[model samples]
Target: MEAKKDNSGRITDWRSYERVLLPSIKDLHRLDVYEENGGYQALRKVLVSDDWTPAKVTDEVKASGLRGRGGAGFPTGLKWSFMPPVDPEVPRFICCNGDESEPGTFKDRQLLEYNPHSLFEGILLACYAISAGTAFLYIRGEFADWITHIEVELAKLYEKGYAGKNIMGSDFSVEIVIHKGAGAYICGEESSLMNSLEGERAYPRVKPPFPAQKGVWGYPTTINNVETLAAIPTILNKGGDWFASVGAERHPGPVLYGVSGHVNRPGVYEYPTGILITDLIYKVAGGIRNGKKLKAIVPGGSSTPILRADMIEGVRMDAESLKEAGSMMGTAGMLVMDEDTDIVGFLRRITHFYHHESCGQCTPCREGTGWLEDIVSRLERGEGHYRDLDLLTDLCTQMEGRTVCALADAAAWPVRYTVERFRDEFEARCRPSLVPAGISI
Candidate 1:
């Protein structure tokens, strides 16, 4: 595939990247060819080379300006550096978050499905950089097919001496274990994920003595998104500066954007940051599936605020800038809605997800999510009154800042933003009328 942007707006690069990333993603099913295509070269180099130190790896990553691709876009190297100084007495580990459950975001699954060794190598290198002896890949339980993909690929990697004890015949070691989560959206959050991994119902925990200070059985454990770890090999192998150039200056690298809904070719595309949202939906996805008109979009995942068609101009695919646009670049889940889409019905469906997924550990999120969904359901069915909108706003405000974690805030952001931007449509349907007493609302 050519690396240049085409007239169609779809990225014409990954077909060629497949050649370069062969065995990694290029020749995935063929294990021997994977090795022949330079699969474990990066890990071998890092493990055997005396010139590079853990500090050097961390410093280079910091210089690269690579942020977490999961959503928040926190600097990856900075987060890894938060690991407390290696304590021989205390157990230290790194946990790779492969639980990709965000709505409209399935890009991470492709990375894990088609080319899992990239993630494996990345995880091993992360442990090596942080001096972690034991690392775990926390994969979501729903990925039944990819579980076999990962299991097979991992066994091949282990046979190649890329994993298990004493890798590359060196003194350093990182024993990787694959643990699965029992389908929970909250498990995508790091703390809640840790909880689920520990054989309990996934729920948020208090912070301040954050996960870095104590985690995973009360040891210093590092949790990073699967996509975050997948970027490590390329960054270390090609130099951080090169990796930084792949995307926009703020959040650089080839972001795997999952563009779905009302698009012709709705799938994941690897592209540089700052690509116009219009180009992505229209050009890349073949212009909204058919002759339909574009309406609004969720630039990030569902947690982000909505952006009307006019608002997508010059929107860089970065973190801070997306926040400036009254949305977040969350999990790179780009959902495009068509003009004929029912805005009320949409919110009803999304609100249902927030309510069902709420852990109920906290009062505001547990109660508030249910309230938001009830209001949305009523409004969708044309059974709501005008005062209900005010009630919705007030309830969302109450839940926004009072939860144990950001799940409550996540539920409220879209509810508040959808009404704020599209009140006319909602009010048109939801406003109560004392018409005929015989007629149903």
Candidate 2:
């Protein structure tokens, strides 16, 4: 695993890095294979050991600096600590979000498909920590095959006594239920997912009664992303400090960088956090397709603010660095655009997605998303006016932060950022305003 690096000491070869989330072991999804690779040892250690407790587990994860991989990047341990003290009379639940519905995000699917036991084990660990008897594993409905695969593996866990009734002959008993989503993008949101789980329409719930306080059927619940939970086993196996030492000081540990768009090798590459954007596009993903100059990037998923190529000159793929770089480390689903890319058309497509995915509960999101798509589509079709540009930005301002969920903000971001970053391209497509810039209608 000797990595070739430039003078800056950044690993130029992604292969040199050892993978944690997506390990190299063959058939690692199988219970025996996962067990052979040291799976569930953390669960057994925690459940059986006198030295470990729920608080200690939470603290260890806090020390690891692991953040939510499902767009938000909040501290996982801190989220775990939010669960109220375990009450034997009252039940708590652990919801594993496997709804990888974001357009550019596909890494969670691999984890569910290739190494599900880790997730199952992680779910079990979460149940113990929260003092919950039941855990719900929510997966996207489009992943029918993967859902079936997980079901088979889950049955194996039950057969081996790793799940249901008792675990490793200990007092702790847990049951995992697999709930398949209807492929709604809004269901990816924690509250919306909970609502959908409770047999209600998938709409993002209002806050204050946040999932921590009241969740899925009115139980104190802790919802974690699939990748976030999968990382738990490794963090517990290799001490949290060791996990913290692997990547960037602020946001550490291995991340499944799902690089897509105009790249020679557009696939999920497992590397430590804070990998230079250039190192990922050039070294890991085998550089831009056909050696074209880099144009722009949606550094996270489609929801994150888009960045011009120049803006990402020294950017690293971590939450802190990306924030400084004017974007977010959203799902680490980097969408690379080549120099010849159509900015306006790309924005049109993105706006369409958010518009279609809006749950319609929020007035701002439901209407605003539609307006965004209509405006972007108008520009793409060569019927937009120069005034439409200002209108788009204005619409974004009105839509952003006005909805119950971030979908409005998500829809607004690309419209605002793309128009601002690549205004020239948009201006080229638009007709001049009918009146002077200062004139009223």
Candidate 3:
């Protein structure tokens, strides 16, 4: 597990940040090869060196305007600040949420599978920022390979004096433990993840005892999403001003967008915020396969509302702009739909996903998601009563903010947007020229 340290060596561009992006073809997919590069340098830079104070790091993050890439785009620095500042006697903890389970989002895996060291670097940087000495990486169990991959990296750090007690010849020390979740999407929720880490149900707890003040074995902890932390070393290596300069004014820094569903190029793209949806699809992804015209798009992941292609002008890569557009830049999961995609059918598919993922602890989310999915499925299959549209919208209204967590609210946005904005198309779907036998024509 001893990774050879080489701080001077580097790869170029986005790959420059990734192990796969390493110059040597021979090192491709090899575990030890990653450490040979400047893998743990950031960790060493923070804990090993006394150059930058934790407060200085926090200020830079605030300047960067780096919002969380996981669903809610809450400012990362603000979240860190929310925690009770360092207590000399009390120990603080930080956990990196690596469960990339959100539908249409798979970018965290890229960071794990290719540029794991970058993620590891960010993890250590967060520990230093919060004055924390203990960190946990809650990787999704489905990605067992990543668990193995990062575990090896963690071991490498420990053996090389980058992790464990008395790290980097300093009194300040940090240990990162890689924990595997039992594959529940709810575990992505900070509280739920904390609960799961402690061998409890995945259902979310009501907020008040925010994870910052009381979390993970009852200690002040800072829980950060993977992509949120992965962007750190770059912020450190480059200055805060440099980090802020990369993306849109409000939401700065590069976003690894996972374009999927119906598109010509269905993979990851690392571009800065404010990347136009049209350009992301048309220019970068080469538009839909076989010259299909754009129909609707889910600007973020399935949680965000469905947006028409004409709404492209309003779509911004930042959370503020996306929120203004009646959706969110949630996890930057862009699902491009062609003209052939049925709006009703699309809703049905997403409804199923949400329904399946709902923790069922919140009554509203448990019932509402299922209700929405059932109704949407019926509507897509030409089983609509016109009254059902109003029913569905009402169902969403009940779900929004009525539940313990935003999961219910997340379920509601899409249904509400689809019914209000695209009612005609949905109603038309119910009355096809040749309806199936059981459904009313």
Candidate 4:
């Protein structure tokens, strides 16, 4: 099949000949428009037909090999299977983590706004699979527009018997409640989100009893990202093999990449995984803005390590490939930088964000993030010392494994990567000629 580029000149048909998860549907946010485009067909197929049992629904997802879109890339089916056997006496819950707080990550917000029914359908299927009676979607408070979009569709569902009790005239009933977060970055974490939803401070809880074991309100629960669940209805409508046939072999599925920074066209593009970084930047995102040479690219979200332009060569945008490149496929937020970008100054801004967002629950994250911020701020202002580089590296090493969560590690990666890859720039700033007099050698 020939590849077709959309009106915006993006290749609609990428590695996969089809668009499964994110199809080009007009007026998709509305319930009527969604139904016209085969929106709730999957839900009806599973709910009305006796053939699709809850176990079958999970097995199909397992076969499809869908991974979590929220950074970790954990298999979605495997996560659902982790829940303990459902007890009729005790209710299970599903929490949709719609808080897209990661820097440069906004794909979830699109799903929430443009294709909300897909999320609702996916939630219904998940509720059935896990025997969950109650489902809560925790949207970030800042997404006022997205909140309005989803709430409008949700009201339609309740009116049409697609949500609320006795869904689609079946004995299975699921209740979905929308909860807005208090705009805390830490609340993006699943455990912390649960804490926030329950009216507690947004600090991550100890995880010996993982969410599947004990979650919101201290009950059996499962949490999935908006993008992760959004893929479910597609998997159900099409067989699992069809879903797995596209994208990278190991992590086969359509993936959404949010391109920002110095890209010519900064928008969310959905393509099968395993697409080369260079291709996405050049072909998809229209290369470096203003035809400038590429300096670096954050292959995933800000949490992942940065990749020098040279390192990005021949690198496929998938979980394992990005990991092999000493980074991660975090939220797939591909942030590109051009020749004029200042590595030290750029990373200092990132350091400030993490330092400010650290929940202060763990000593290492609480203190280490502040130290990173101070050091990077100094480096950006040309007040850095030669010895400060080593101190910063040591500080990052101390923060990585010692924090209660990955917050400290996220704060450390850009600092470490920018210093390592673009050391000449940082070193130049710390030179005796550049350092101010009386600043101490």
Candidate 5:
């Protein structure tokens, strides 16, 4: 499908692109329906064929340029390769991070709700690739309805012999388990999710003995995002080159853009990566609600640095482009804002979420998030002083890169970026200091 572009060379007909992750097929959640539509064929191909080995599966995905759909855009196949040569006596595990707890990130929820079998197939493929017999699908506790639906569907897979011992009548046998998280946002972090799976307190573990080296139950494990795993089936069905050629050259493949906030049609839209921010806002999402002018955008999830309207002029929704534009392609969960939005109040609410969700494991995150919430709350109430802006920036430096996990960094980003990017808006809300220039507090 040829996309129509404006004079500016921006793709106007984004709808022309095919949807891979969230296809429009009906009853896709059902096993029979999924099978009818070429689902699980990838897994079968890998398991039954002599040509498609575990190493081959990893190599194909690596060729696809598939990155982690989770916050970090790490290469998916490279991650699977990290699993040490499988030991028959020892157990290796695949943890599917279905904890869709990141604010503004709801695409994974739709995947589980509408087309769960893809994720199941993806998980199985991952298990085969990593030489693991078991895969844990860790979902957040808040997705109760979807969890039940997934469990029901999973039972159907087992009954059909798609899962369990000698799946598809091949020697390769695997078990898929659905794990419901306690709704802790920190659990979305890989190490923390592993801890929760082991029935321990959900806390971020230090790296070095990283999950690939030492994971849940201290076995070699590979933790992948729900969307990341779900994309695997497609990579195998179509050649890896086909998938890689679809999107931004570096970060290729279709991505689920979860657009929310001021857009009129706020929901998940599947399109190739590197779609222009403007085309997504105007063409796909039907523009700003009520014709309000654009103000700012939290291009990725809440943790990604917020961008001014001008900053996104030529920005594309991919890791490299976003990074060059001073933001990260974090979940591609775009939270748009209108001209009338209260910048200070908006940031206050975001700060509150990170503050409440901090696992309290590290002092930087534990104490820093609380302090951030307090300062932002003060600014939102119009009680903040001009020095509070500098203080907020200072607190971010202390919190960022200091915590065990990125929780502290997540909390600090919006505050630091918002304060710096929208300094005038924040300054307008704050009371000016009475002290003379260069006066110390």
Candidate 6:
């Protein structure tokens, strides 16, 4: 995969591209190969160096300008800094969210399958920063292959004296446990993931005390995304300025963009953020499938607002740029649609996902998602009334920012954006044929 240097376009010269989070290393799956290629060296340096304290680690992360790759784009170092003073007597925890169930997003599965040890190295670094003794790697149940890969790598770490106590003959020790989720989308959320990890129903919790303050069995817990934590060791090895210099300033560091849908090559591309949408689709992703003209794009995952081809001009694939373009760089899952694609049918498919995934903990999300799905289904079947469009928008407005989690808002975003952008298609779907002038049915 090539990298994007600026808004100008994709850089085909792969030799010049900086691969940090997803670095290319030979025999990457093997622990010995990983260590030989400079893996776990950061952990050893931190464990031994007097200058490498938890505060310094957090400061370096902050300096790097690394943001959470898990949709929210929250500052990772700021989140780690929120943890209370690490006490030897008190227990702190780190939960690595691997629940990669978001529609159009599968980058985490790539990292877990191909480069499992990078994740472990990241978990170790995060544990050091947050003063965590135990780290839980929460993976979704559907990802059996990924889970197996992680389990195998974890056993190797244990055997190599990398996971257990007295690691590398140092007092700093940490344990990593892998937990498989029951295929719930809500479990991807930090608070909800903690609940699922505790063997409770996977429902989102209200945020008064955020996860950093009290998470997972009432401890000072910091939950990092799989990609966010996976990039930590790289940030530690290279200076923070180097990491910051790679991507956009606001959201720096390497980003894994999972391009799907009408793209000729639908795979995860590890490129720096701030690449233009046009360059990503055409240059990196091998353009539209079947040589069809571009129609629309879901810049992020299914939950993000849909963007018409015209709206994509000069739009960089970053948080600030997308937000300014009336969308978000959510999960960096770009789903392209060609000219032949059915916009109304696409809306129906996405609405169905949110409807099925609603945990029913919040009234707006529970009822609102179902309502959106029903209206969309009716429209698909040519049974929709003219007022249904207005009704759908109203329901989405009511649901946005009202639920315990962003699931409701996420559910609402694509609906409102699609309706607002492709109103003609939605209107045409509602009424199969226009009534003859002055001729009543």
Best by lDDT: 5
Query: Would you give me the overall lDDT of model 2?
Result: 0.90
Residue range 1-441, candidate 3, lDDT tens digits: 222222432111232232222223444334366556555565667665677788878888888888888878889999988879667899889989988788888988877777777777788788888889889899999999878887776677778776777877877688888889877888888988888888888878788799887898788988888888888877777667766766577787778888997787898888767767777788778789889888888877877888888887846677777778777888888898888977888788878988999999988899889999998988888867677899998999889998777888877888999888789988886643465789864
Candidate 1, residues 1-441, lDDT tens digits: the string is 345544544333333332222233456645575556566678888778897888888887888788888777889899989999988898888998888888988988988866677788889888888888888898889997887788887887688777887888998778888887778889888888778777877887788678888888778888988878887877787788867655466777777888988888998887766667777887777888678888999987898999887787877667766777778899888999999989999999999999999999999999999999999999988889888888899998899889878999999999999998889889988755556878785
| TM value for model 6 | 0.95
**Model 2 ranges off by over 4 Å:** 1-15, 435-441
TM-score of every model versus the real structure? 0.93, 0.96, 0.89, 0.95, 0.96, 0.95
Number of clashing pairs per prediction, in order: 5, 0, 0, 0, 0, 0
TM-score of 1: 0.93
Better of 2 and 4 by lDDT: 2
lDDT of 5 by residue, 26-65 (tens): 9999999999999999998888889999999999999999
Clash pairs for candidate 4: none
lDDT, candidate 6, equals 0.89
lDDT: which is higher, 1 or 2? 2
Total clashes in model 5, counting residue pairs 3 or more apart in sequence or in different chains: 0
lDDT per residue for candidate 2 within 1-441, as digits (tens), equals: 654554545433355667777878999999999999888999999988988887888889999999999999999999999998767888889999999999899999989888898899888887887788889999999999999998999999999999999789998999899999987999999999999999999989889798888999998999999999999988899889877876677888888899999999999888988889999999889999898999999988999999999999888998889999999999999999999999998999999999999999989889999999998999999999999999999999999899898989989998999999999999999987777678686
Clashing pairs in 5: none
Better of 1 and 4 by lDDT: 4
Candidates' lDDT values, in order?
A: 0.81, 0.90, 0.79, 0.87, 0.91, 0.89
Q: Tell me which of candidates 2 and 5 scores higher on lDDT.
A: 5
Ten residues in sequence with the least summed lDDT for candidate 1: 15-24
lDDT of 6 by residue, 229-301 (tens): 9999998998787788775777877899999998899999898788889989999899998889999999989
Cα misplacement distance, residue 400 of candidate 1 (Å): 1.0
